[model samples]
Target: MIPEDHFGSDAVATNRMHSAGVALEELLVTAQKQDCLTVGIYESAKLLIADPDSVVLCVLAVDNEEDVALQIHFTLLQAFCCDNGITILRVFGVRRLQRLLRGEGANRNLEEHGDFHCMLVTNPQADHCRLQEVDTYCQESRRMDQWIPELSLQER
Candidate 1:
């Protein structure tokens, strides 16, 4: 009982999601290479509090939606980002992102870096195209009434 327009809209949404994911992946990789990436919730929060202006983007990832503590942390982080005028994106698949950032078979130094729930891309010396792409996607999502658009990180 679905109308023809329903399928068309679904396809468009899928395309937009895919584009956002790719853009995010590219941004993360570039930030990592540039050494402008900050990992973990505590570390990112400290960085935000210490130097908010240096942060260009904040990405919150969640694999377990039932974690109340994590949810609260995200809420606080979102409010901070909003107040500071920093673009924030919600993504799923924290494990995938951890592997992507830390690399395969990397040592787990949770004590030093904390978990990979929140990541921040700090200011890079040079202009980045991926950053612009992500910003554009965020703006489009906001226009569509999505305050914090959710994206998925591809499994490699």
Candidate 2:
């Protein structure tokens, strides 16, 4: 039988993770509304290279681990984000992210935007609460020795 303390700790961790996921989703939505979001691998990479200082956070969504090219891009992006002092968050479920960011009618833009794998949230016009939440979560994760901590955006 498991101890009650163990169950309490597990519950705390799960709640933290859920809050972090919600924070990420809200941050993305806010960025989109403010026109401070750069989506797609090429676009995000270009923005990161051209204006690294403007990028506040980098969110990577990977649905296919078997894709060699995608892995290479993620590796390079991780290096760049680290060098630039940008927070990087890895997430699962690209489709869920797309739906969250673009809504149900976003299929038309998919062809134009390529994929929702890589996204960069740039500096917004005003301070955002969700950004702070995500930043805190990242800081805590780092303190826990989790480099490039990942969160799932999929529905529970």
Candidate 3:
């Protein structure tokens, strides 16, 4: 799995999160306590948006100064932030990311930067290379025709 540092976020900050491989239900419970924003893709996010039990996106900015719940929520964010399936690039000041995605720039930049892992998968299973069969749930969901550019992680 690609680490969050590959995306260029504070790797140390993300690394500090303890993996709680407990259970989905337990995670959800922790999420609720932490007030995480649910980040969904395509239409799947609609269900999360409508549901009060959870938020709809992964990158949420809940204030953690008040208590540990929010901190726990952020911990979860940091956990998935480095997800190997996802390419969470660090966008400092440019909206050029849209262009990067629209073009095959992501793949090319990886080669140019010697950081190809930033855009393309390294040593993926033979099935992942096919693109069409790759599921959005896999994290690197760029293959599906349904993937909208807006849902893509863009930093302002």
Q: What is the total number of backbone clashes in candidate 3?
A: 8
Mind giving the per-residue lDDT tens digits that candidate 2 earns over 31-149?
77677888999999889889999999999998778999999999999999999999999888788787777674334444366589999999855565599888888888889999998
Off by over 4 Å in 3: 1-57, 85-156
Q: Model 3, 62: alpha-carbon shift in Å?
A: 2.2
Model 1 pairs in collision: none
lDDT of each residue in 1-156, candidate 1, tens digit only? 999999999999889888888888878877776768888888899999999999989999998899999999999999999999999999998887766767643334532454889989998564554898888888888899989978876677
Ranked by lDDT, the better of candidates 1 and 3 is: 1
* TM-score of model number 1: 0.89
- lDDT tens string, model 3, 33-143? 333312222222243234423222232222114547544544443344444233222212122322333343233322333211112122222222222212222243234
| Candidate of highest TM-score | 2
Cα-based TM-score, every candidate: 0.89, 0.90, 0.20
Displacement of the residue 109 alpha carbon in candidate 2, Å: 5.4
- Candidates in order have lDDT scores of 0.84, 0.84, 0.28
Q: Which stretches of candidate 2 lie over 4 Å from their true place?
A: 104-112
